[model samples]
Target: MSYDLVIRNGIVVDGTGARRYRADVAVADGKVADIGKVTEGARRTIDADGLVVAPGFVDPHTHYDAQICWDGAVTPSSWHGVTSVVMGNCGVGIAPCRPAAREIAMRDLVSVEGIPFDVLNKGITWDWETFPQFMDAAAARRPSLNLAFIAPLTPFRHYVMGEASMERAADAEETAKIAALIAEAVDVGALGFSSTTLNQHMGFEGKPLACRNASREELKAYANVLKARGKGAIEIALTRQVGVLEEDQCELLDFLLDESGRPVTFIALFDRDDIPEAVRNTLRLAAPMIAKGARPQTSPLPLTREVNMDNPFSFAAFPSWKRVFADTSKAAQKAVYADPAFRNQFREDLKNPTGFSNWGRVVVHAVRNPALKHLEDKSIAQIGQEQGKDGVDAFLDTVLADNLDCELTMASWNTREDRMRELLNNKAILMALGDGGAHVDMLCDSGYPTYLLGTWVREKEAITLEEGVRKLTSDPADLFGLKDRGRLAKGAPADIAIFDPARIGSNNHGERRYDLPGGAKRIVMPSRGVEYTLVNGAVTWEQGRLTEAKAGKVLRG
Candidate 1:
C-alpha cells in the first residue's frame, strides 16, 4: 500500500525516554502508518539524512488566545516546532464574555498580559460569546498547530458577578453560575480551568484582577465542577508568599487537588539564595500531596519579565505608571516627553518601585537613540557618568526622547544556571512556561525549545538530550492527556520535527517585523537547524520557510 508522505533516513527519538534509532517513518491519512523500512510509493518525501526526528514540542503553558484569533500559525511557537499549544493560561481568557464585557475583558488582558489594548481592540473578532462558542470559533479558524484551551476564571467571574467580580467574594448565586459555566466549558472541550491569585495581576484600571478577589470557597466550588467532570485540570498563578488575612496559597492548592482530585499546576518556582529555605519548604508541602495522588508541578524555569516602557502594557504592574500613561493619547504621549515638568516627574518616578517595575535600571543594550547609538553596549549608569546626569534621569531622558520605543536590557530574575539545571532534572517539574503569544514587545521566549536542546543538552551537557526531548514532548502530552500526538509511534499523529542535533541552536534574541492584523507589532525568534517540521502528516515548515500544507487542527482532549 502506498503512503501519503514519508520522512526518510533520520534518527528517531520516539518521545518515550528511550534511546534513539535510525529509521524511516511513513504517514497516511494524517497518522503514522509505519516506523521503519517505508519503501512504498508516497506523494511526498523529505530527505532528513542528517537530522533527528522527534515528536513536535508540546507547550503546555502559553497565552495565545488572542494571537490565534488572527494568526493561525501562532508564529515563533510554530517556528520553534511546537505542534500543540495550550493557551488561556493565568486565568485570563477572552470567552464566556458578554458584549458589554468585551472591552473590559480586553482591558484586563491588555494590562495583565502586556498585550497592547489597541491591538486587542483592533485585532480580536469577538465572534464568540460563550466558552463553547470560543472553542468552536477556534476550530473553525483552524491554526497551523493543534490548540487547546482552559476555562479562564476571570471572564467567568465577570460574566456571572459583573463588577462585583473584581471587588469581593461571590454570592451563592454567583458561585453556582461560575460552576455551571466551568462545567459547560469542560463539556464543550476546554482542557481545564485557570485562575490567578497573584497580587501582581491587575486590570487595566489598576485594580487587582477579577480572579484575585475570588474567595477560597468560590475557588473550591469552581474546582468541584472540574471534579465532577473528571476531564480537566487546574492552572493557577499564586504568590509564593501569602500575607495575613488571606488563605495561604498552599491551602488553595491543597483544596483544588483534594476537591477536584485532578492535576494542579502553578506558575513558577524560582531559585534565589535568599529564598533557598522557602523552596525547600514548598517541596516539603508538595510531597505529601503528590503522595496522596495529587499532581502538582511548578514551572521549571524562573519567572522573568521583559519590559518596553513605551507601551502602556509595560506599566501594568505600576499603578502610578498606569495613571500617568493610560489616558494619555498617542499625540499627548509624544507631547508629554517634550514637557520638562512631565519629564521630571517621570524621572522622579523612575527612582521608585513603580517606575522601576515599568522602566527599571536597564542598560541600553540595543539602541536607536542617535545620541546614544555609539553606547549600545553600555549601561545607563555608565552613559550617565559620561553625560553628567543621574542614571535614572539619563534613562528617562533618553527613553522619552526616543518616543519610548527604544529597547533596554534589564537583568532577569532567573539567572542561576545551577538552579535551572536542578529544576530541569526534577522528575515532577515540567520544563515549560514560554509565554509565547503575549508580551509582544518585551520577550520572545518561544525559542525555549531550541534553547533547551542546544544549550542544556548539546553544548553545556546540563541534561541529556533524551531527557530534554521527553520533558518537551511526552511529559506535557501525558500530563494533558493528548493521546494522538506527542509520540512518533506507528499509530500516533505525525507531528514531528527534524533537526540537526549537533548544530541545533536558538536564533539570536531580538525583534523582527511581523505585521499582525491592524498593524500590531509582535516580537519573534526563529530557530536554527530545524530542517523540517511536520504537522499531521503534512510538511508545514521546511528549511526555514512555511509550506502550503495547512493540515493543523484545534485539538481537544
Candidate 2:
C-alpha cells in the first residue's frame, strides 16, 4: 500500500525514556501509518538521513489567545519545533466577556500579559462573546500547529460578577453560575480551567487580578466541574509555592484535589539564591500529596526578555508604566515621554529604590539609527554618565532619540546553572513554562524545547539526550492527556521534528522581527537546529521557512 509521505534513515528518539533506534517512518492521511526501513513508494519523501527524528514538542503552557486571531502559524512558536500548544494557561483570555467588558478585557491583556494594545486592538476582530463561540471561531481558522485551550477563570469571574468581581468574593448564586460556565466550557471543548492567586498579577484598576480575590469556597466549587467530567487538569499560579503554602492555601489546594480528582499542576518553583528553600520545600510539600496519590507538578521556565523605555510591561513597577502604554503609536509615546511634567514624575519614581533588574545592569543591545551606532554594548548607567544625566533620563533619552525603538537586555537573572541542571533532571517536575504568544515585545519562550536539547543535552550534559527528548515531547503530552500525538509510534498523529542533535537550539534574544499585523513588532527567538517540522503528516516548516501547510486542528476534550 502507498503512503502519503516518508521520512527515511533517521535516528529515532520515540519520546519515551527508552533506548534510541534507527527507523524509516511512513505517513498517510495525517497519521503515522508504519515505521521501520521501507522501500514502499510514497507521494512525498523527506531525506532525513542523518537527522534525529522525534515526536514534535508539545508546549504545555502558552498565551496565544489573541495572536492566533491574526497569526494562524503563531510565529516564533511554529518557528521552533513546537507542533502543539496549550493556550489560556495563566487564567487570562478574551471570552465569556460582555460587549461592555471588551475594552476591559483588551486592556487587561495589555496590563497583565504585555501584549501591545495596538496588536490586540487592530489584530483581533473580537468576533465571539462566549467560550464555545470563541472555540468555534478558533476552529474555523487553520492554525499551523495543533491548539488546545483551558477556560480562563478571570474572564469567567468578570462575566458573572462585572464591576464587583474584585471588590468582594462571589456570592453563592454567582459562584454557582461561574461553576456552570466552567463546566459548560469544559463540556464544549476547553481542556480544563486555570486560575491565579498571585498578588503581583494586578488586573483592572491596579488591584490583584480578580481570581486572586476568589474565596476558597469559590475555587472548590469551580474545580468540581472537573470532578463532574471525570477528566481534566488544574493549572494554578499559586498564592505561594507548594512548599510554603499557608494553612488556608493548603486547605484550598487539598479541597480542590479531593473534590476534583484530577491532576493539579501549580506554577513555578524558581531555583533562586534568595529563596534557597524554594526547590526542596516545594518537593517536601508534594511528597505526602503524591503518597496519597495526587498528581502535583511544578516547572520552571528560562525566561529572558528584551526591554525598551516604550514597553510598559517590562518596568511596570515604575509608577509611570500606565502612561508609557497610554498611547498606541511610537510618536504618541514619544510625546508622552517628552512631556516635562511626566519626565519629572518618572525621575522621582526612579530615585526610589527598586529590587527588580537594575538599570545599571542593562546593556544597550542594538542601535537601529546610524548616528547612534557607537552606543551599542554600553551599559545604561554608562550611557547616563556619559550624557551627564541620571539613569532614567539616560535610558529614556536614548530611546526618545531613536523614536522609542531602542532595545535593552537585562542581566540573565534567574536560571542558575546548578539550579537548572537539578530542575531539568527531576523526572517528577514536568518541565513547562513557555509563555510563547504573550509578551510579544518583552519575552519569547517558544524556543525552550530546542534550548533544552541543545544546551542541556548536547553541551552541558545535565540530562541525557533520551531524557531531554522525553521531557520535551511525550512527558507534557501525557500529562495533558493528548492522545496519539507525543510518541513516535504507528497510529499516532504524525507530528514530528527532525533535527541535528548537535545543532538543535534556540537563538539568543538579540534577534527580532516586525511581522505582526499592522506592523506591530515582537521579540522572536528563532530556533537554530531544527530542519523540518511536520504536523498531521504534512510539512509545515523546512529549512527555517514555513511552508503553506495549515494542517493543524483545534484539539477538543
Candidate 3:
C-alpha cells in the first residue's frame, strides 16, 4: 500500500506514557496509516534517524486570537514543534465584539495581555462579530497548526452589557443573554468558556476585567450550561495572588466543580520564594477539588520577564500601579514615577512578600542612555545600596532617567529545581500555563515543550522521556477533549514532532524581532534540534524552517 509520507528509523514515544520503541511511521490521507515496517513507496520521506519522533506538543494555554489573524504560521510555538494550541485563555479575546466596541477589545488586550494596541489595530481583520462567525474566520485563515478556542467571557459580556460589564454584576436579563451567548458559542465550536478573577487582569482604562465582575450566581449559571451539555471544560484565572489562595477562592473552586459536572482547569500553581510553603499548601487545599475533576495547571518554565515600564504589566497587581495605568502618556508616567507619594506607596506595596518584592533578583536589562550603560547588569537592590535609597526608588528613578525606555528583568518563582521536580511528578497537576501568544514583548515561554524534554527529562532526569512527552501531549489534549490527537496510532491525525533528545531545548534568553504589525518589536524564543514537524500528514516545519503548507484546522469541541 502506498502512503503520503513515511518517517524512517526513529524512536517512537507515542505520547501515551508507554515505553519508547523504534518504529517506522507512515501517513496517508492525513492520518497515520501504519507504524511498523513501511516498505511501500511514498511521495515524501523524512529520515528521522537517531531522533525521537513523538506526537506534536499541545500548548493548552495561549492568547493567539489576535496573532492568528496575521501570522498563519504562529511562530516560536510552531518553531518549537507545537502542532496544536488552545487560545483565548484568561477570558480575554477579540471575538463576539461589535464594530463599535472594536477599540475597546484592542485596548483590553493591550492592558491585560501586554499586546501593543497599534499592533492589534494593524493586524486584526475583524471580518466577523459573532462567535460562530469568528470561528469561521479563523478557519478561513488556514493556519499551519491546529487551533482550538475557548469562548472568552469578556467579549460576550461586553457584547451584551456594553460599557457596564466592567462596572457591576449582570442583571437577571443580562445574565440570561450572556449565558445564551456562551451556549451559542459552545454549540458552534468553542471548547467551553473562560473567565478570570485575577486582580492583575486590568482592562481598558485600568478597570478590572469585565469577567472579574461576574458574581458567584452568574458563574454558577454559566457552569450549568456546560452541566446540561456534559461536553465542555472551563478555564478560570483564579484569584490566586502569586501563591496565596483564600478560603473563599477554594470554596469558589468547589462551587464551580459542583455546578459544572464537566472538567474545570484553573490557571496556575507556581512555587513562590517569598512563601516557601505556598505550593504545598495550595496543593493540600486543592486536593479535594482535584479529586473531583478539577485540574490545576502549572508551568515547567520559570517566571522570568523583561519588564518595561511602558506597559508595566509585571506591576499590575500593585495597587500603587493604578496611578501609572490611569494615565499611560509618557509624560504622565514619568511624573508618577518621580512623585514621592507614588514611590512611598510602591515601596509599601513591595513589602507584601509577593513575586515583585525580590528587588535583588531584578536587574537592569538594557538602557538607551550611554552614560547609564554601566548599570545595565546591576540589580535594583545593589543600585539602591550604592545610592543610599530604597530599591523601589532606585528602580523607578532608573526608569524615569531613561524616559521609560529602559528594560529591566525580574526573575521570580518556579526556579527551584527541587520544587519543580515535585510539581512535575504530580499526576493530578496538568502541565500548562505557557502563556504563549501573550506578553509579546515581556516574555516568550512558548518553547517550554522542548525545555521540558531537554532540561527536565534529559538533563535533570526529573521524569522519563515518555512521561515528558505524555505531559505535553495527551494530558492537555484530554483536558480539552481534542479528538484523535496527542497520540500516534492507526487512523490518528498525523501531527508529529521529530527532534534530537540530546540537543532539544531553547536558549536562556529570547532574541528581539521587529516582525509584528506596524514594525513593532517582540521577543521570539527559538528552539534547537526540532528537525521536523508535520500537521495532518503535511511537512509544515522541516529542518529549523517553516514550509508554506497551511494544514491547520479550527478544532471544534
Best by TM-score: 3
lDDT of 2 by residue, 1-557 (tens): 88999999998999997888889999999999998977899998988878999999888889999989988898788977889998887788898888899877887788778787888888887789999999888878988999888898999999999978868899999999999999999988788888887767777777667777788889889878898888788887764532244556555667678878887777665554445566667667666555533443433344557776554455767787667766757778888777888888877776654333356667788878889988888988899889898777787788888877777776433456787777777777767777877878766767878887888888889898889889888888876668676899999999999999878887445366888878877888878889999999889999989999999988887
Clash totals for all models, in order?
0, 0, 0
Cα lDDT of candidate 3 equals 0.89
What lDDT, from 0 to 1, does candidate 2 have? 0.79
Scored by Cα lDDT, where does model 1 land?
Answer: 0.76
- TM-score list, all predictions: 0.86, 0.86, 0.93
1 against 3, candidate with superior TM-score: 3
**Which one wins on lDDT?**
3
Task: Report lDDT per candidate.
Answer: 0.76, 0.79, 0.89
Clashing pairs in 2: none
- Per-residue accuracy of model 3 over 418-493 as CA lDDT, tens digit each: 9999999999988887788788887888888988888899999999999999999998998888867899888899
Point out where model 2 deviates above 4 Å: 239-251, 290-301, 310-361, 367-375, 378-406
Per-prediction RMSD in angstroms? 4.3, 4.5, 2.6
Q: Which regions in candidate 1 have their CA more than 4 angstroms from the true location? A: 240-247, 272-281, 290-361, 380-406
Tens digits of per-residue lDDT, candidate 1, 1-557, equal 98898889988988888998999989899898999888898988888787899999899889999888888888888877788899888899888899998988988888888788888888898999988888899888867888888888999998998888888889888899899988888877788889887777888487788888888788889888877877778888765442111237667777888888778777566454434444456666766655644443444333334456655454444333544565566566656555677656656554543323322335665566687588676777777788898765677677776667677666434455776676677777767778878877666777788888888888879888788888889988877768777788988988998889988878435465658666767777778888888888888788898877777887776
Q: Which of candidates 1 and 2 is the stronger one according to TM-score?
A: 1
